[model samples]
Target chain A: MLEVLAERFNYAVIIVLMMVGLYAVIATGNLVKRLVGLSIFQTSVFLLYISVSKVFGGAPPIFDYKDLAYDKLDPNAIYSNPLPHVLILTAIVVGVATLSVGLALVVRIREAYGSIEDDTLAEADYSLELEKGV
Target chain B: MSASDITQYFDYIFMAMLLCIGIAVIRLRNLFAVVMLTGAYSLISAAWFVSLDAVDVGFTEAAVGAGISTVLLLGAMLLTSREADKTSLGRHAAAAVVTIAAGAGLFYALGDMPVYGDAASPANTGVGMEYVDLTAEQIVIPNVVTAVLASYRGFDTMGEVFVVFAAGLGVALLIGLGGSKREED
Candidate 1:
């Protein structure tokens, strides 16, 4: 157990960050702050993937074509795993786009309700519903 | 301690900074400062990613996470309240419970994960190496990550581009361009 803890301590720390993000998303009434929490959570996952790709004494995934011929590729050459990097590239773009749209929606919500706090927005919504009922 | 040991300590320092920043983001009531701290947090994360030899991922994180996202958050902050309301103590207690429980559960699950940076770890030994090995012959790109993203995962990348486009459209529809003649009229 001690050995496992020592080896994977990084992951435990990252998971703690993930939880902090999760808490912010759920607990914060400010919509933009919630999005910040969402960003933190997404980033923690990205770090986990990057951590998984690390290779001891490995160079970056970029190949230096000037140094070595493609045909005579060195079998023993070490490079950090590139697959996770590729996967996360697309994800990062999507994250930014999603955040932009979320912000725009927050702008619209503020325009509608005169407040961006989730609780205040919900109160406005419930009052609208009550007015219709009465 | 050797150079590698020193680097490991740097990692520890970065991780500690990340933890402190995360707590600060949650505890602070000032929305603008929280957004700025989030940007700083992501920049540190990019530094960590670069240290892990994920230069491409780090680059993307710096551009998207710290750059574009911060600008968007700031623009939104311009339209929203600057400070968040304080929640009840009961809500704080509930949030703390939920966060600690989730963290403990994930920590327990970490015991089964492959040790960090092990060359033979499943993530490295699987299709990961095949991409590295074949990128030279098949794609001829200096960056294997770029080759795989453009050639091997063309469909997924295209979908992501379309998603970005759609998101832009959605934002434009929701919040019209302020300087546009259509909005001015």
Candidate 2:
């Protein structure tokens, strides 16, 4: 069963991590916790991509001729796709940029409301909207 | 079951997981949780893409779906409320039902999709073959995924970056700039 699970483990883990992140986002009222959930959720995708790139018996794409012990490339060798790894590298950078900007905004929201609870913030916004008569 | 049989049944498992995660994402009441579930849904879909051997597409989807989208969603949620009016649940339920129905219909409609790596697929038969055949010699990138995404799909990537920039700008505008404080009247 473990081996079977391992065969599709990448998909399984991705789904589980997603649910965990989802639960955090749904259950937690704290803004920072929500952000953390969001980060976890995103990181799971990174794992998914990395997992997908693995071929059944593939070796890394690196090619080095200095080692005389190393044989030449075998035409039938199954090399795990390296494209996904490169893509995820770009994505991780983008995710970091987005997270930093988001955290900065959360700080501003906290400053404005003096609290991060959704209800309190909503009430404050409603009152402001009411006063403005928009 | 033999190894091939196991691989065959993996498809059903992936589909079931996708459905379950999708439902959870919609059914969950917490806005933050919903966003997180949405990320899960994306990861599941990315796995499906990998199963199809669209490794490059899967990578792009996994990153955008799970990473950038989640952060942007949480940013939007932060400026808003997680606890919505209880009265809105009925409408939300209706929306959920409609969404599921439409999604199911779409899935059913695609029953004729070519099998993964089928010889007739455009990626297998046409100029794509030239791409696959010539990648090592022409690009010297070693990784076909990189060659396709960075070189062949460069224009699309530039557009994707622009979209991300636009989304960040929109969020900034919605939340305001430099943390200006409003005076209490």
Give the winner by TM-score: 1
lDDT of 2 at A124: 94
Cand. 1 TM to true fold: 0.94
**lDDT, candidate 2, residue B128?**
42
- For model 1, the stretches where C-alpha displacement exceeds 4 angstroms are A69-72, B1-6, B179-185
- Candidate 1 residue-wise lDDT, B16-82, digit = tens: 9999999999999999899999999999999998888888888888988899899889889988889
Candidates in order, TM-scores: namely: 0.94, 0.51
Worst 10 residues of 1 chain A by lDDT: A66-75
Clashing pairs in 2: A25-B32, A25-B33, A26-B33
lDDT of 1 by residue, A1-134 (tens): 87787777778788988998999887888899999999999999988888888877788988777644536567788998999999887898898999999999999998988998888888888999999996
Tens digits of lDDT, candidate 2, A51-122: 555443344443233321243434454444555555665675566557656766776687789767666678
Instruction: Kindly give the stretch of ten consecutive residues in candidate 2 chain A with the minimal lDDT sum.
Output: A62-71
